[model samples]
Target: MDEVEVVVAHSERATLRVGDVFLKVDTDQARIDVEVEVMTLAPVPTPEVLWRKPPVLALAAVPGTTLGSLGGPSTGSPAAWAAAGATIRKLHDAPLPPLRGRSGRSIAALTAELDDECELLVTNGLLPADLVTRNRQIAETALRPWTPAFTHGDLQIAHVFVEGDEVTGIIDWSEAGQGDALSDLATFTLGHEEHLDDVLAGYGTDVDLDVIHAWWSLRSLLAIRWLNEHGFDPFAPGCEVDVLRSRM
Candidate 1:
């Protein structure tokens, strides 16, 4: 019998892997619906959905290792990162998923969310005041409107799977929808800033470096609180906090 490996376990959800099958257990059935819909609509590779029963979503595991993990060195080659970028480009160019939940958030809402999160960071002393302030200021650049694209909301390195130089699959589509393209880029390169250029290269388009940098600041700031609350330290060495400090 194959051992059930706990892939990820948290307050909101948990995923277990048994051999080639992954069992995703979550409270939000709506999110599972979105994942199924997005995987069907997306023009890129995704895990094959074997079945779903409310809280349990069974998916066949993609045949490759994760591109990388947060705060860890990426074993994926530059070419693999580039391939992942190309895959993202393909998704962005595809028709938007036809779902109300896939609609991008309004700028006002995003601004308010950012403001609230920033206050929490400062109040908790989770990060230095100056660092928080500067990054918050820099993050303002990303608050503007963007032409929505089919975006993989959480395109972290870990969610990207690759076989050799080819991207085999992208997982975790609960956040997929029409949104700012750079948000996906920023999330993909979050703690792995050094790979940004390689990704952009394969994305095969020019991008605003300033906005991308701003998103780096914005994303890291917003995520620290959630990470901490989830029992992960954002301030650990070479982690999200280090990524923020690198800006200064």
Candidate 2:
């Protein structure tokens, strides 16, 4: 029997890899439903659904490794990064899914949440007050009105795979929804400023650099607390903390 490798485990969900199959166990069935539904609707390559039972959804592992990860040295050549960007552009251009669930959580609601999180980050000494304040200022632009697009809400670098210069698959669709397209780009390129140009090379020339920058601040600020409580270190070098400080 093949050994089961733990892919990711957190309070909300856990994913296990046994040989070529990945078993996802989520606490909320709705999240699993969303993942499955979006995976079916998304135009990009996704893991094949093997089976699903309640909170456990099984999928065949996609070929190729991830593009790279935050806080780590980037892998693959500029071409590979551009390929990933092209893949993102394809997803963004695809027909919008019905659920506006994760990404477009409403500007007013997100603004309120960002303010609350900033206050907590400062009050609890979770982050330096100056750091929080500066990021909050930078994050303001992300709150402004913007056109919507089909988005992979948590389009982290690790979620995208590339073999050579070909993007093989994109995983993790629980957060997929209609939202500001910049947020997707921001999430993918967060902590990877040097690669932004490379990504945009394939993504497009019409992108708003400022909004993407704002999203970098907004996403990093919003993630610190949750990441800390989840036993993850947001302050790790090249991680969320560094991402926030880079904006200052």
Candidate 3:
């Protein structure tokens, strides 16, 4: 290896890029197992798996810049965002991957979790009580039942890679499983609301905006605390906090 570049580092896992290979290090074996299996099953392009050993998975790097960064404008064209939407649609249509744990949860469970997170936010003064309550109310609309689809689970903009208006690949499959298709859409468009039309046009289907908005609130509320603890600031300009406030 010539030199190593840290791609992402937090408490749970760290990814490093050296030469043309990316090394993902995580103490959790089950997460690695899911990543490998989900990549094999995913319909869209993904980084090629070079090899894997305990606590380390080496992957051939995908040749493209990431689609965008959180809290920042994407240089990718509208066409590129649309291409990503099409890719996500294809993934949702693929066969579901088998996993050892629960791929999704019931509405009751999601609601319970949301309630707990909201309480924590309020109690800790992490957010204004009114803001948290309003977002929580907005999030409730997404708890309705839906047919399970193959979902990427964490389709943040940074996970999608593109080159010349084409989506080359998506990275990070640890959370892939059967879940709400809208969740992927909501996640991808979280901080990039301006591109929603492009993505929806390429999705080639009608989606309920209310459900998408609900998911936006749900995901942001659930993730804000953990993101902060992990050295990510969801409250940064145009990030998750902004996404939530946009609802009000």
Best prediction by TM-score: 2
Candidate 2 residues 1-248, lDDT tens each? Answer: 99999988899899999999999999798889889999999999999999988879999999999867999988889999999999999999999899885669889999999999999999999899999999999999989887779999999999998988999999999999888899999999998889999999999999989989999999988999999998899999999999998878
Q: Count the backbone clashes (under 3 Å) in each candidate.
A: 0, 0, 0
Error of 3 at 232 (Å): 1.5
After superposing candidate 1 on the true structure, give the runs of residues whose Cα lies further than 4 Å from its correct spot.
Answer: 100-103
Q: Give the range of the ten consecutive residues with the poorest summed lDDT in model 1.
A: 96-105
Q: Pairing residues by index, what is the TM-score of model 2?
A: 0.98
Model 1 Cα RMSD, Å?
Answer: 1.4
TM-score of each: 0.96, 0.98, 0.96
Cα lDDT for residue 204, candidate 3: 72
Ranking by lDDT: 2, 3, 1
The true-structure Cα RMSD of candidate 3 reads 1.4
Candidate 3 structure quality by residue, lDDT tens digits, 24-48? 9999998998998989988899999
| Position 140, candidate 1: lDDT | 95
Q: In terms of lDDT, which candidate is stronger, 2 or 3?
A: 2
Q: Which lDDT value does model 3 have at 115?
A: 95
Find the number of clashing residue pairs for candidate 1. 0
Which residue pairs in model 1 clash with each other? none
